[model samples]
Target: MKQTATLKFIRKHSALAPICLIILLFIRPTYLYAEELKLPDIGDSAATALTLTEEKMMGAAVIRNIRHAGKLVDDPLLIEYINNLGNKLVSVSNNKDYRFNFFIIDDMSINAFALPGGYIGIHYGLITASRNESELASVLAHEIAHVTQRHHARAYDLGKSYQVPVLAALIAAIVLGSNGNELGQAALASIAAGSAQMRLDFTRANEKEADRLGIKILNKAGFDAHSMASFFEQMYKESRLYGSQGPEFLRTHPVSQNRMAEAKLRANQMQLKQPPSSEAYYLIKQRIEILNQPDDKALLNHYVLQLKNKTYTVREATLYGYAIALLRNKQLNQARKVIQQLRKQAPSRIAYLITEAQIAAQSQQYAKALYLYKSALDDYPGNTPLTLNYIEALLKQQKYGRAKSILVTHLRQPSPAPKLYKLLALIESKLGNQVATYEALAHYYYHIGQTHQALNQVNLALKTPSLDFYTESRLSARKKELQDELTALAKKPS
Candidate 1:
């Protein structure tokens, strides 16, 4: 049968029409799939239903991504000890489905930050500045609240549109190999260009929520809720005295009179069951002081004066802090004298023996640093940090082969810090492995001259997916320096 004019027209256009339709589908996916892809309502209640497992995976991903792009401090004992404290806090958290991790950054800035899951960073400066364990716990507890409350996810959901520019900046750099400064400048510019008032309001709201939740969590964990108030009180006083130029704590985290009053009121409301300080708290405190404390000499002198005035607690804390200073300064005999007194006063304290061993090492007494580390291990076996310290002492004595063996064996074990990877890099560098040497050398070079580098290397490092603040800073600085250099070079007489 002969076809009608309409049918003939349809037959001729069918092939081309389907192809055109397919092209439209590819180009305008949003219109086609908008209903299916719409985001869930990011109401306050919606955040509560986010699974702990999802949070953990996201948190761990953030940790791993940032770790790859930055340098983590390589102290085993410190990392393990802080993780233990974090675990204790997690045990008492209202939401205990997820695991908490604590990492100590080499950064001296007095700040603590949390990732979406359970990744918490306790800055070396925060540890040093804290007067006691409860002060540190206050910071940890606050971070734990951030995780439990799903603040990261909630923030992401609320500000998904705002992240577009930051995300674009990152993607452009990765795709185009843009100069480090260009990428960092792009990212920082986006942060600066955003609505500052809105950001501040959000931050303040989160901070208040975190403060109340942290106090409740601490009280439940048998910590003194008053300690949180006390910690902020000290920080507030420090802010008044220093007035904006003080430690980094005041810079990133602002404290005000209202905050202090509110914190105190919250603390007063809580029925805290205070518990005695555990051995872990004291040990971590000792480690913090040893690794930190800029004015060691003055600290010792002050301690002596305090002792003469019969200020027992300050005297005790200072003596413990001073003993480590003495070891570090190579005053072995003096350290021994201080530790001997400490041993007499607090017999069976493992910290004194550890200090004793360190002093012995400083005085060419390897046998003792070795013996004391071993003795501490015997008392506290499975102490990965102390064991690593023992291995380090051996390495100090030029026992590379033995240290290498121990490091290799432990490489198979769980390591929060990449100890084995570091050891392998160091050992291979020592053995004249050119490839290994350059890899380690590149890392060192980038770390030491962070803000300045060959344009090529700076551009390369900026391509990393999840840039940490340090890497971000380095890339920014290097980019500026290189741009300036190029401008000057272009203006030369040649």
Candidate 2:
């Protein structure tokens, strides 16, 4: 029955098949005999099994698939917040050489997972569920440890004696299992029923090591070291409350009394300190709450009730969320009033300033909005959210040239948001620069994992009339890169 459910789940999510195939293609058993295989050693032997480049490729491919499935949260504010928080922990981590990319999964499940190559994904639900920043940081630190320890590669190394298909299935199962779906649970169970006990034992060991290291990283990063243990204890208690259906995090990172005790004991040995959570964390949480609401009026009403009853923990964040809800509901005057109140409290708070600017823009006061953005930019120059908003206000006023210039400057920075490319495409289109528009659109599509659309845009650019020699050369080269990527993807076993 479990096997049937597992197969059904795999068939339903057909996009995952290519991910498995990618893993199989990259990870092959060179030594057929188990006796001849040398097990992974303590010191970076996993690197020998799966090179960093291969791990990166695998991680990127999985991320692309996840993006294609629309499971990646695209909110720039939330993205920036999570990355900033993740980097804070990364900065103090022992693995200084590894480049970490942190992202949020749009999932509501309370889980986090680490893909190969330092790609860590936290569920928005986990963020919402966390009582404080340290709880969230602890989760991120644990995932970071998994990546730094090269657990995925080490698992591949350990599984060399097993069939490649089994190993691939196991990898897929683990990813899906973190989602807390019945089919995913079935898949995991089916895989475990096989001769995967040794791998399971290794996973438990990895979990322990990750806990120890995560606590150290958390403490070093100035977070409460006990957060790891506290979070686990909370999850364990919640598991009892939910009976057989605990949090997805527990399904993946099973918390036991013994494990919790060990974490507590380790944390007790550290110099504990209570650090205040950042205001940005609360503001971002409220923003996400507003974004997740399906109905603006309903959300506005909910916030009104919360405020009326004084049920909110953070009044400023509640007000922030209420203001956004009001804006979304097109209560422009009320939204402006609320945001003005917030601005009066903290004249330079970016979230309040942005909200006020948005209110002005929505009221069709584009000049006021532009002035507000410009004033904020003067204070916080090169701020991504501010720059993005300012460029957007410029575009709204049909000041395409100014918007283009600002956007171009922003794009020159490393890893600009994908939305920026899409915005640039709009700016170029407004200016009637067909080649530039197409090129920008191609970049936008590529970043969002729409390779075919990206390739189409590139082709369109190359076919544009009177294209300059230089532009044509660049477009042609990009076109080949896209084609090669597509060809390689197509070549993966079905």
Candidate 3:
């Protein structure tokens, strides 16, 4: 009789009770009202039918925190490579424009996450954890699945708006200088925090569904579908070996027994005829490790292995990757020599050109860097990353006028990034145009930072035209926060 009752409870609750028991014992619940609540109407309809303006707005707030909390790894070649793979998968994905932005975060955490409207955050740790491009694709496709499936929106409507609170909490922690991986773990803890087993697995089911969908997407995109299962199997083994000391990614994204089984079963069913070539795998793996490791004998040790294998183009690219890593580590002289060789090998690569310019600028050869940047633009028109680097070089040289000119030109062209406004503010300030500078800064601050001055700036800047969805969202959120702050200040003054 007791067993029957226990089974009934477990059935009704799904598989969330275990997670809840673990989390509730540690932290107080933020959304107790959402614990095991039901809302069939939530997130069931197509995205086309739902009003997403508010969700997109909430996403903007979190994006600023995400961008601020994590450093964007700016290897154009690697980014292009990753994006090419991502775009291939996205082509077959339902959320096509969710125009997914993929960038490496400068962290060692083995994790990946996505924000609404196509923002994907990948860690160097996760990059290294992935054995190949297909495995990396599995991670991205999973996150993209969340956005496509509207999991956050569903979570919001079902649970009464947890996304905003979670984003706010994360941003707050970041502002307080908390470690991003640590804060991210905390955020994930709060996700299924106080829920019952049934409720928690409801979300896990979504995760499982995403995994299945992502595998299918990979299969169609000509990537090895089994890579998903292979990566999961590796992660599972690592988890067991390390026990609780495993990567915190496993903690938030708890690799349940069923998930592992499903991954294996799915991989076997797919029976891919060929894996991604060893060269591609090595490219991703070496790039990941080179980026992850600090400037130590460890990097040199790996370099020795590459040196011994002259026939390996993958190793050669890794050598170039190591050189770039060395430059980032402030080994300027070593970086210059390696880059010079890289340029000799691939003279037409814009990234090598930019790196050379960066090296010259670092050595206070501003004119050299400036000339290289100009030549690069002339050669490769409409290269966004190079354009950003060129402007950065100009700013470093205190060529505020040229920087502003670049910003104005770029802003006028088609489909500019909202972050450009923030850059403009910096350049304007450098130009000693305080009035225009404050106005621009206000736009960036209020929209990106959700500050009062930012609200004021947005109002000033957009007096007579349509604001992009990103800026509009920022303006609204900042205005609200500012109003609340003013109300509290007014009360204190009395």
Which number leads on lDDT?
2
The TM-score leader among the candidates is 2
Q: Compute each candidate's TM-score over C-alphas.
A: 0.61, 0.83, 0.68
Model 1: per-residue Cα lDDT over 1-494, one tens digit each: 01132234235444322322222221111112212325343345344333565455444533433343453455655777788777777778776555677887666656666654567777777886777777788888877876776554433321432332233232222212223244334443443344311110133455577788888878877788888778877877887888655665654455667777888899999886666666556666656655655776865665566567776444555677777767666677988999889888876666666677777877888887887887777787656666677777977777777666665665566433444455555765566554443333343433332223345455665665677788678667866765553342232121
Instruction: Please give the lDDT score for candidate 1.
Output: 0.58
Residue 425 lDDT, candidate 1, scale 0-100 = 57
lDDT of 2 by residue, 1-494 (tens): 12234356457555454333223222221101222223343444434466677566656655655565567888777888898899899888888546788888777778776776777888888899899999999988887877777666654442333333233234444344333252133333433343332221133466677788899999999999999889878888888999656676665455668777898999999997779888889998888788788987899899999999999879999999999999999999999999999989899888899899999999989889999999888888778889998998898789999998888988987667788999999999889998889999998888776788999999998888898889889999999988877654333222
Task: Give the range of the ten consecutive residues with the poorest summed lDDT in model 2.
Answer: 25-34
Q: lDDT for each of the candidates?
A: 0.58, 0.73, 0.60
Worst 10 residues of 3 by lDDT: 24-33
lDDT of 1 at 178: 29
Candidate 3 per-residue lDDT, tens place, 1-494, comes to 02233344335444434432322211111112222344233334333222366455545655555544445565655666667667777888887335566666666767666654455667777877776677877777767666676554433232342434354434333322343254334443454343311122134365567777777777777778777767767877888999867764665455656666787677677757455554444555666666567666677656666667664456556766667666666788988998889789777677678778888888888898899889889888767767888888888778888888877887776435446777898887777765566566765564444455665764565453565677657656755766664343222111
Query: Alpha-carbon error at 343 in model 3, in Å?
Result: 3.0
- Which of the two, 1 or 2, has more TM-score? 2
lDDT of 3: 0.60
Task: lDDT winner between 1 and 3, please give it.
Answer: 3
